[model samples]
Target: MATAKKLPSGSYRVRVYDKVTGKYRSFTAPTKREAEHKAAEFLRYRVDTRDTRLTVREVCQRYINERSNVLSPASIDRYQRILDKQLSEDFKDTYLEKLSESIITDEVNRLCGKYTPKTVKTTVHFFLPIIRKHRRDLELDDIRLPKVFPKVKEYPEPAVIMQLFRGDRMELEVLLALCYGLRKEEIRGLRSSDLSGNVLTIRRVMIDVGRTSVVRENAAKTVNSIRSITVAPFVADLIQARSGDYVTSMSGQAIYKHFSRVMAKAGYSITFHDLRHINASVMLYLGVPDKYAMERGGWATDNTLKKVYQSTFSDQRKRFDDMVDNYFSKIYDTNI
Candidate 1:
């Protein structure tokens, strides 16, 4: 039930009692009759909200559907996995509005014990948006997350990457990753038509999703990802020799399996993606400008160049330091 109150502006304000929250919800109407009508609608809405038991699972399903076209296929798969695997079973059936910070925090803490800190962080990251959109009353500030440490990405030496490039099975894949710093999906996404003279356009990426091993073709990772990169003459020659519409016929999983065997046989412990990191390290070591390196590697931002993939080989750093030391010695000798 709601009551009407006369306002200073001569408008009738309707106040409705929200039984669930025990708070008064107010709405303004121009006339007393309109105010009463508005209050009745508010009470009806309160009843409907309580009757509708939309679960977290339902909200997550809706979220995925809404974001399917916007997010990359891989990202959508990740979100689905988080909802199904990472989130606790206790809350899946709970109503969206009924969830509290304590319940979410307990679940997150339990997940931290089972999963890595990064995985737990990802779970929380995906969970917040759903509650924000559906349960605006649930305050997220009470949830305390565990401390997360970033894992440092280690890159193989330039010589190690070169050695992989000479291998027979994964030669082309290694070359594309090492030379252009292309991601695994980007390497798999390359097509013959993408090659125009010496330049290669990266407009799309191939993503492997789900347990079924379905490969989905999607647009580039970001807006800046759709750009052209000039290939070295050797890379161009290799592309010219390759058959099929795409660069390599092997799927990303197949390439990874091949790369693992190649590394095992060669007694080097490096992942396929290490080749891309090696390319960035070499570029930074050779004093390539940040902008040029970002553009050449299809990196969307300069921060990624500086923070993510800028580790130089220790030997190269030593050589650079020695050069500086020698130059300073020469200057001192001239002054003396």
Candidate 2:
């Protein structure tokens, strides 16, 4: 048995055998109180909770690593950046047991006031669940953690949602998205088996994981995602143009880029997903049932689309006024 000794600085030193790797290591800290507390905790844990081997950082690493095969490269990069650049710096050495609600809440508040509520909320979304999920999977109890983020923005403006859809090779995909509300991954993961004339089936997604590997056909995010969508004549033409050779890649960035070019040429600030909003807006304006639109958009719940994804009715009223006013001015060339 190794002895515990006091150094000149009033610190305590003790050697411990790591149950996991069966290695012995020495630890020195500034106080005997802390050393005894740590030592007792470790020895007790070695007997009662030896199986719970995950640290906060370790579990988080595994979650992100395993998700790489299913998430996109861009998404993986985003999650990793948050961990490596932000959360890891603060919580890397934090034992999961010591992490408290107050500590988490303080961190969340610090971040919330620092960035847009949207940006900060997303950061919370990425981390809060990650911690709890790992803890729960291990059947740990009463982990008094911080509050998860509330809903972000309540409803993101359709214009803002559309903004994310602009870019190269994105025209057709944009049309599908804005017109259909297809996610970026869903559009990129599309394949020939999902097509039959003007109807397209959405079944799988393509994701670039860890910026290194490309994984395809991981299936859609929900059961409702496996549905058929009718293609517009213009979109049909583009799809037709690519027939026999218009293949999608492991990454869908090219589709988005192409979409931006086409929208720019069409003289509209349009994007892949803007069309989705346009579709939703048009249907709502034309009085299509929200339930039907929800189904067409492959939305499982109407509340989210009505609350977030679908366009507002007020915009349609303003557009009606603007169209009438513009028509008269164009016909008569009036200044007022």
Candidate 3:
């Protein structure tokens, strides 16, 4: 607390330190009480004004800074990328108090023209929570966002994929994804110590943040993602043969590039991530129950397993449908 002092002119003056401006602010009045009250009011107004004047970019950065210790490196990197690249200068510079639905809607519309609906949605979703943390009065319910349609991905047959990568440099990476339904991060984080006999434990993940890779020990995408599953005999042998602290020394980029080249050479257009889907598809084809499949794949919920991973191969679906149609056709002919 600061006290008022008598001035040479018989008036009272009070000085208070403004930490935000790194300067002392002075208030003068005819009386000591009035001068102290004026200084108090000015300090209160300064704090309120400063908060209202905070820009979107500033608030977002502050939020990221405050949560840096708690948030994963991948998450921090994503937020930083969004702050740097995704947000428009106008949107970022807008004062938090001036933020409105119209402004947000315009930004979203602008994003839609340049990016996919999913990307626009992700950007908006990431931006909104930071705003709400500061401005609780802001209502976002009426903001219309573009609808995101699920992509129908076609993956190569398990046999074809295995045959292609059997002796390649990325065989272990492919095997982990295709056989165990491991995410690329999990595949990259695999260590020699995580393997015991035929069982392989998924206890960590290595994610790409900008140009660098970050490893999170005893951490995974989800609680269920941290699991252990038995590997086949041949898979175990491959693991045993690898001589390093990690199962594979290849970086995520190298694995993706090699996978893309192999798939392209085989006349298939697919991504490294598609191998996880192929694993799920194989499980579905073999009549594996949802419970077992979910456990094996480390999926958090049945809904996710069914919605994203569980898909019948086009050829397999056609073959099964054809069998049913033929049976029905024979019955109709007999009745006729």
Candidate 4:
């Protein structure tokens, strides 16, 4: 432990040896005890792995291995997939010490040609953290990545969405997504125990990794995602009619395929995930407050809620505007 010394400027500074940098690092605070405490805390949790011989791929694998117990299965699977398919062999083989900003930028630019801008951005974002875990001193600022444009998604009216799946095998799935804004994973993870009368609690999630589905109990996409919402009478009846440990027996893939096929036949090309947009649109259409809508949809922030709200159907906006205009016109005529 290094003792803190008062400087000419009247600030306390402590010099602590960092194993990674092979040099003494400085921690400064207003008080002598605070400076020493800061240095001591750093020494307590400092990782001593200063292995300069590790390659980029090796560091990524090491990170993945270290976080295996903590990270979700789906996250691990996606990381592995990115390591295998997204990373270039040359980039992976490059030594961590030798990796430069230009190398990362070049790889990102190359990936933009092969994959979407969003995919390229995701790959670079995931790769950067692996590098930084081992080499904290590296400045990876302003590594140019492809710009991700906001995608315009079209969703059908709530009524049409209801009519399409009414009395069908996937009706329960549709109702859960549209009525409650429950994610597909949450829907698959639902069990009879999760339903108590008309109130359905979203507590678990089932994510697909490779060919199989992995269920995580008492877990969801976010803390806000684990919520309880009152279900509609028809939705409650549908859940009661089903006899199984899980509410819906369909796998994630099966649900997606069935939803897609049904939607395709109706001449609308939309995904099961888009039901959430429909849910958001309905909330916006019905003038549901941002707070309640966000809670129901498991949105962590109002930013996402505002995006969906702003993207509400053009026709619906026009209809509402016209109705208001007609009402104003009638009032003006009465005054004359």
Clashing pairs for model 4 are none
Prediction 3 global C-alpha lDDT: 0.79
Clashes of each: 0, 23, 0, 0
**Please, what are the lDDT tens digits per residue for candidate 4 over residues 145-237?**
777888786777666767777678998898788766789999999998888986788999998999988999988987768777767556778
Task: Answer with 2 or 4, whichever has the higher TM-score.
Answer: 4
Q: Write the per-residue lDDT of candidate 3 for residues 1-336, one digit (tens) a residue.
A: 599999999999999999768899899999999999998877654544567689999988998899898999888998899889988999999998898878988888899999999888888888887776666566678878889998886776666777787678888788788877999999889998899987789999998888988899888887668777767666777888899898888888888889999999999888898888887776787666566567678875645645433454346544543443343234333433
Candidate 1, residues 1-336, lDDT tens digits: the string is 556889999999987778778888888889888999987865653433643378888878788989998787788899999888878778788786677778777777898899987778888889777766555555677776677875575555555555555637567778777766888888888888889997788887877887543444446676556667666555677788888888887887898888878777877667788777777776777676566567667775645544423453246544543443343234323433
RMSD (Å) per prediction: 10.1, 12.7, 11.9, 10.2
- TM-scores for every candidate against the unseen true structure: 0.72, 0.54, 0.73, 0.75
Error of 4 at 193 (Å): 2.3
lDDT ranking from best candidate downward: 3, 4, 1, 2
Candidate 1 ranges with C-alpha deviation above 4 Å? 1-52, 211-218, 264-268, 301-336
- What lDDT does the true structure give each of the candidates? 0.71, 0.58, 0.79, 0.79
Encode model 2's per-residue lDDT on 1-336: one tens digit a residue.
355689887888888787657787676777766766676666554522332345656667777899986765667777887677666356655666666666676676677666666666567778777666434333224323344555422233434333444333444565566556777777776766566886777877666555553434545656566566666555566566554422354255555566657556655455445555555665676565555567667766535544533443356534542442243224223321
